[model samples]
Target: MKAWALLGAPKNQWPSNIKAKLLAAKKSKDLIIGVDRGALLLEELGLTADLAVGDFDSLQKDELERIESKVSDIRYSLPEKDLTDSELIMRCAFCDYQVSHLAILGATGGRLDHFMSNLLMVLKPEFNPFAEKIELIDQQNSIKFYNAGKHTIYQIPDYNYFGVVTLTAVQHLNIAGAKYSLADFNGDYPISFSSNEFLSEKKPLELSLKKGTVAVIQSKDIDRFQNI
Candidate 1:
């Protein structure tokens, strides 16, 4: 799949391991974009961005100029808008560029509202076609959305735990190859199964659903000493 990576404005710095993964993706010809202050972060990390987007609200004039100097394509939005900067970039990537997959970094560490909005954006009706292709990555978690279908989830060696949560009403859901297995289960609002581990390192986790959308998360447990 042709992948695109977007850098969003987050409160904390990205960890080195995640940065390395993004660097590899960039090297493999993934279109990279920086959203507002994220452009500065990309510059600092020595990464090349195809474009820098969003209103220069969070940055000073000089900072925006620096980004402009580094990135050739710059897109500006009105200060007041219905869509967030990240959402605007998403629209551009999916609609304009028509990329098959997207990996979003620096999305989780900002304001609670913004983080939640970023996470829920994939659930939007307009984004349904790209739902399975979008992923939100942070230091501790990699979040992916899926529609009603059978899914095979591979174990991430870096992450110890996995979670599956229903974003909407789910019917005839089955899960296997996990420490706790579920079959033909139905979930209503706010239903989540957390802290599940893979049954085998080589075998993948299997999930099937007849209806509704869900988020699959591979995460490192902060409470655990080994990962922390």
Candidate 2:
């Protein structure tokens, strides 16, 4: 798969494992997009964005200049625009490069509004086509969406728990190979099955849905939450 990385500005420090993952993706020919101060953060980590984009109000003039000097391509939006810098990155990624698979970093532990916006953006009409290809990733968890279909989820060595949440009403949802197994579950609104663990460390989790879309999250232990 062609991977794309999008970085945002968050209050928490970026995790080392995720940094390594981004580097691996870069080595595999994935492109990176950095928004505002995220561009500076990428430069600090010895990485350069293929495209650096944002309103850039948060960055000082010298910082912006530094990013401009290093990034191969850059675009600026008006500070008063409707979309957040993160959304701008996603828009350009899809329109300019037809990005299909994307990994997002620095999306959590920031302003609550920004964090919630990042999570819900995938459900927007403009994002529906790429829903399954987008993921919100951090050191503690990786979140992905799926439309009605049979799917298999693998255990991430870094995470010990998983959750399945209905973004909308779902019908006939079934899950297996987890601590809690559900069969023929139906719900009228968004529902969350949280803090579940793999049945066996060696096997993958199985899930199927006859109708509706869902979000799946593989997360580290709660005690490790601080690290995120």
Candidate 3:
């Protein structure tokens, strides 16, 4: 099964066609897990959350009550817990639901700390095994994780730019089928290879890494940057 974890980023940061996305997911019978105010967003969209998970500190009493009344399955966490709400939701998706793919939405354009936590969580040992199955998405960008291996990435429609960034010290890395190709690139620390485009949409971008984790981001040019 596939699952979608909706986070609590500001509504303005949500994708313009979020409703359509959710509707499609629903049609495919994907599990929808809402985190914190994300549950509220689903409710507002006239959608039902399969499960709700979060401390919900961002929601007012009435709002929390509303979600409690609507959603049947909820896992409440303490605000002082060791794991972030996003992490908890991911764990539930992979371990409990046994989802083969997990798409995360509303993870960006919030507090920088929160965004970083969501982006880097897949690097953790507990989550690393599923890195390739996870994706973080927003209005303008789609971020997917990769481990040490040769992988093929197909171009995403409407996204003109592609980027690769190391999450840790990386060994020999190679990128091909892109405007700016790389051969045997090595880095001791995190670095970004940005603004690279696919040479042809019909061709798949190839990536090979000997060690460490990397995130490949596909993005489109937007008229104005959303506030972070």
Candidate 4:
């Protein structure tokens, strides 16, 4: 089964159509797991989370009580635990629930450290096996992880730009069906092939890699100043 995890990033950073996205997931019977303040967001949207997981340091007594009342299954963690709330929820989704695919929302655009942590957590030995099964999504971007392999990436609508970023030293990288294709590229360190676009939305973008973990980020231009 698929699962969708809602993390506790800033509300302003949430996708404008977050409700619609969640509704679609709900329609597809995807398990919804809310992390910390993300549970509150679900409540505010008149939806109940399938499970709630977090230390909930950001919540007050009443807010925690409210979530407790709404969600049937809640997992509490110590605030001083070694794992971050994001990692906790991810582990729960993958290990406990054994979800095939986990789509994470509200993981970006708030507290650069937290965003970075979420992005890099999949690199851990424990999570690396499931890297390609996880995706981080926000208003302006959708980021998918990959291990060394030939992969086909279908375009996500409204995302005009596509990028391939190496999280580690990558070898024999090739990109096709893009505005700017790469052939037999190798890098000793993390690098980004950014600002590429799909040659045709109908055709899938092809990527091949011999070694390393990679992140495919599809994004749309947004007015940085408008929300600030």
Candidate 5:
């Protein structure tokens, strides 16, 4: 699948882990789009976007002009619009590029409001069916959703941690090949099952579902909670 990864410059610049993911995506000819200040981040990294989108609100006049002059492809959304730059990225990805999937970076690890909005934006019903294609990756984790099915989890190099979070109420959710195994495990809302590890070094992990949706997050970044 031809993937498009969007990087949003939300106050802070991209983290090392997130940068690696973007570079990895670029290797596969994944189209990269930047929103607002994110475009500047892309420029700072010596990377130019396939297309630049969103209002020029976050940048100075000189910066905006420089970007506009250099980037021939762009979609400038009005500042009066209801959608955020991140939303603009989603719109272009689905409505324009018609991409099967997208990976979004720099949406996390900043202002709480911006982070939450970028995250919850993917949960909209119009995009829910293709939610599998959208992921919000950061320094600490890579997260995405699965509606209801059996999925073979691929191994990401250096990804040593995982967690199962019930977005809605779920029953009969079975997770295999983990430090804490489960069978028909009922996960309640607001309850994030955390700090789990893969047990089998040979096979891929399997998650079987019975009802509702499950959000899985995997990470190789060391937990800051235990960084002593």
Candidate 6:
């Protein structure tokens, strides 16, 4: 499967520790697309992008010129829009790039509303089906939402902590191979049932769902994402 990552509004929001992971993904992926301010992060990281997207609203003139010169596609969006820059770029990737899996960075830490909106974006009908594949990753936690199905989650080495949360209403949930265990679980609003630590370094946690979609998050150190 192919992987792609988009960086958005990185500025002071970039996590120093996650830079290595970003670099590794860039080398392992088919393409890296930067959205608006994310282009700046790509440049700052000294990584060239295969594609760039945005109105160039958040970037300076020289930066914009530099990016446009390197990438084959520099798709632009209107400054005024119902969609955020990240959402716009994601739409582009789903259409043109046809990437099977996507991870987004520079998406958290800036604004509470923005962060939650981004997290909750996966709840959209158009986006939910891709949740099992589309992930939001940072230095600390890698989060994604999945619909009613069984999923085998592997270790990132960096993210050894695993948790499953009910985004909507879910029942008959089964969780195994963690510090805390659950069986035939039922969850409601504001209730996150399965938050467990990965005790077995050699094995991964297995999540089996019988009903609704869940928010799965894996973290090495949750605190790493604290300041954003």
For each candidate in the order shown, give its overall lDDT on alpha carbons.
Answer: 0.79, 0.80, 0.90, 0.89, 0.74, 0.73
Highest lDDT, which number?
A: 3
Better of 2 and 5 by lDDT: 2
TM values, all candidates: 0.90, 0.88, 0.96, 0.94, 0.83, 0.83
Best by TM-score: 3
Per-model C-alpha RMSD: 2.4, 2.5, 1.8, 1.6, 3.1, 3.1
| Model 1: lDDT of residue 69 | 84
User: lDDT: which is higher, 1 or 3?
Assistant: 3
Which scores greater on TM-score, model 2 or model 5? 2
lDDT of 6 by residue, 72-154 (tens): 88878887877766666667777667888777777776777878777777777766776777787665677877788787777
User: Candidate 6, which ten residues in sequence have the lowest lDDT sum?
Assistant: 9-18
Global CA lDDT computed for model 1: 0.79
Candidates ranked, most accurate by lDDT first: 3, 4, 2, 1, 5, 6
Stretches of candidate 2 above 4 Å error? 11-13, 222-228
Worst 10 residues of 2 by lDDT: 4-13
Per-residue alpha-carbon lDDT of candidate 5 for residues 92-147, written as tens digits (9 for 90 to 100): 78788888788777777667788777766656676667767787776667888877
Off by over 4 Å in 3: 224-228
The CA-based lDDT of model 2 is what? Answer: 0.80
